[model samples]
Target: MKMKCLYVAVAAAVLSLAACRSSKDAVSVNDLDGEWNVVEIQGQAVQAESQPFIGFDAQDGRVYGYTGCNRLMGALTLSKPNKIELGQMASTLMACPDMETERLMLNALASVKSLKCSGKTLVLYGADKEPVMLLQKRFEVVPLSSLKGDWRVVSLYGAALPEGMETVPALNFDVTANRVTGNSGCNRLSGAINHDGADENSISFGNVASTRMACPDMDTENQVLSALNSVRSYGLLDNGRLALMSEGGTIVLELERSK
Candidate 1:
C-alpha cells in the first residue's frame, strides 16, 4: 500500500511538471501579432526598395509570415519568454525576382535557434554561428500575380540528353500544345501535359507513348524518366528553354521546343 501510494504521488508530480512545461512552451498568438519589417537583411543595409519587410504572426502557437516574397508557415515551441525552437518551415512556390534575398531570409529564419526582443527590435540569431538579422514592426502590401507560366528546364543532370536505352530514354517536352514528344533519349516518345497554370505552380505529364529503342546510356535514360515523373514546378525563362524545377526549386531538366 505504501509503495503504491508513493508511485501515485510520483506520477502526479511528473504530470504536474509536464503540464507546467507545456504551458511555459505555449506561445500566445498575440506575441507574434503585428508586422515585422526587415531592418537588416543578410547583413546588408535596407534600401528604399527593401523598405517593406516581412510580417509574422502567431496563431494558436503556430507561426505564419510573409517573407517579402512568399507565404511562410512553421511551428515554434517557446521554451521560455525569450527562447524558442524554430520548427521546419514550408513556403509558397512564388519565385522571387531577387532569389538571393529570399534565400537569405529563409536560411536565416530556419537557422533561428533562439530569439529575443529589445525595445522595438527583434533580433534573430541563426543556428551554428550563423549571422544575426534584426527586424522591426511595420505594415506590408503583397502582390497577387507573383508566379505564373509554362516553364522549361535551365539544365539537366545525367547525359544532358541520353544517347540510347530501351525501356527508359532521353526526353524533352513542349508546353504550348500541352504536349511532350521526344526521344526517350533512346526511344521516341509522345505525351500529354497538364498544369495548374497558377503563378504558384503544379504540373505533370500524362500517359506517355514511346518507340522502344535499344541503344546504350541506360543511366541517362533513367535520369530522364525520373525527371519527367517528378516534375512539380516550372519556370518560363527569357530564352526559349522551359526550365522545369522540382518542388524544392532545383532545376531538373530543360525542355526546348524541338524544331
Candidate 2:
C-alpha cells in the first residue's frame, strides 16, 4: 500500500511539471503587438540609441519601422503556435553610415521563425532555434505639447534638397497661436493649423500664404508648397523626426527637430 501511494504522488508531480512547462511556452498574437526597440543583436548590445525601431500593427497584420538607416515595411504572420513568419520586407533606400547594422537587422528579421515574449522583452529565434535578436518594448509616447517647436526639413517628397540651395527650409509650430510659420526654400510661409482634439496623431493646415519671392529655382519651393497644402496628418518618428502625411496617407515630408 505504501508503494502504491508513492507511485501516485510521483505521477501527480510529473503532471504538475508538464502543466508549468506548457504555460511557459504558450504565446498569443497579442504578445507580439506594439512597438519594439532592438536592444541587442546576436547577443551583442546595440549602442545606437538614435536609430530606428520596429513596430507591429496587429490590427492590420503589418509590421513597419525604421531599420537604423531606412524605413522598412513587411507583413507579419502568426498562424501557427510558437511560430511567426515575417514576410519579404520593403524599405526606402537612403544611404547612411550605419548601413551595416541595418543589413544585419533586416537579415535577422527575415530569418526569424519563432518568437518569445517575456514581460516587455521580445526575442526572435531563427530556424535553428537560436536567438537572433532581442527587442524591448518602446514606451516613449510623443505628447501633443511636444509638437510645438522648430523643425528642419530633412526630406521633401522623399528626396534631399539640392546641394546649393539658397536656404534650407524650416518650420516652426506655435501651439499657442495655432499657426505654423516656415521658410519654404524661397518664400516665408505662415498659416493657421487645425488641432481638432487632444489627439496629436492628426493635424491639418488651413489656407497657407507665402511671400511672392522667386528664387533661381522654383522647383523646390513649388514641391514644398504643394506638399504643405496636401498635408492631412503628422506623426513623430524615431530619432525626433516628424512625418507629415497627405490626405491619401502618403508621407510627403520628413523633418527633424532643430537643435
Candidate 3:
C-alpha cells in the first residue's frame, strides 16, 4: 500500500512540472503593444463585417478596444508570464443586429487566465488553459521602412495561383537601393520602386523588366508584370500578408512575408 501511495505522489509531481513548463513558454505581456484585429473566438472565425479589435498600453497598463458594436476599456495587470488580469471591463451600452460575438469577447477577457504571443499574433487562454481568443496585428497605415524584406506571391489578381508551376512569383525589397529583385513566375525580374512622395504608404513599381525565358506559365508571368506596374499603394494585412493596391483601392496582389 505504501508503494502505491508513493507512485501516486510521483505522478502528481510530474503533472505539476508539466503545467509549470507550459506557463514558462508564454511570451511577456509587454509584447501586446499594438492594436490587434480579433480574428477568432473559441477557434471559430468571426464573420461579422464590422471588425472587432483590441489594443494595449504598456506604459499605462490600460486596455481599450472596439467590440464591433461598442467600445470597451479597462485596467490591465500582469503578475507573471502567461497570466493576465483585466479589471472590471466596461463597454458602451449600444445595440446591434447581433451581440453574440461581443458577449463572447467580453467573457473571454473576464475569464482568460493565461496568454501566448508570437511575433504578430496573440492568443488568450482561459482557466482551463485552452485558447479562448485569437488576434493578429492590424496596421492602419504602413510605411516604406516596414516593408523592407522578402515576400512571396500568395495570390495573383485576387485569385489563387495555379498548382504544379515550375516557379512561383516572388520579390525581395532592397530599400537602400530602392530596388526589388525576384522571380516573376517564369523569369528572373529586377525593378525599381518609387515612393509616391505624398505619403509613406503610396508607392509604385517602375521599369520592372525580366528575363526572356519562355516557360509554360508565361501567361501568368505577363499578368504578374502588369499587376506590378499597376500597384499604387500597399497595406499590411493580418497573418503577415502584404497587399499591393491599385489606383481604385483594389488588391492587385497578395504577398506573404518570407525569410
- Which of the numbered candidates is closest to the native, going by highest lDDT? 3
Off by over 4 Å in 1: 1-107, 110-154, 158-176, 198-200, 237-241, 256-259
Per-model TM-score, in order, reads 0.41, 0.53, 0.48
Q: Model 1: per-residue lDDT, tens digit, 148-228?
A: 232222245412543222333334445556777666456666787777744334567678666666656756655666777
Q: Across residues 36-149, which tens digit of lDDT does each residue of candidate 3 receive?
A: 789999999987656788877655788888787878999888755557888889888999987998998898888888788765678888899899899886654567887788
242 Cα displacement, candidate 2 (Å): 3.7
Q: Going through the candidates in order, what is the number of backbone clashes in each? A: 15, 0, 0
Q: Residue 125 error for model 3, in Å? A: 0.6
Arrange candidates, best lDDT first: 3, 2, 1
Residue 62, model 1: lDDT of 61
Root-mean-square deviation of Cα positions for candidate 1 versus the true structure, in angstroms: 15.0
Clashing pairs in 2: none
Task: Assess candidate 1 and give its lDDT.
Answer: 0.55
Number of the predicted model whose TM-score against the real structure is largest: 2
**Predictions in order: lDDT:** 0.55, 0.77, 0.79
lDDT of model 1 at residue 213? 62
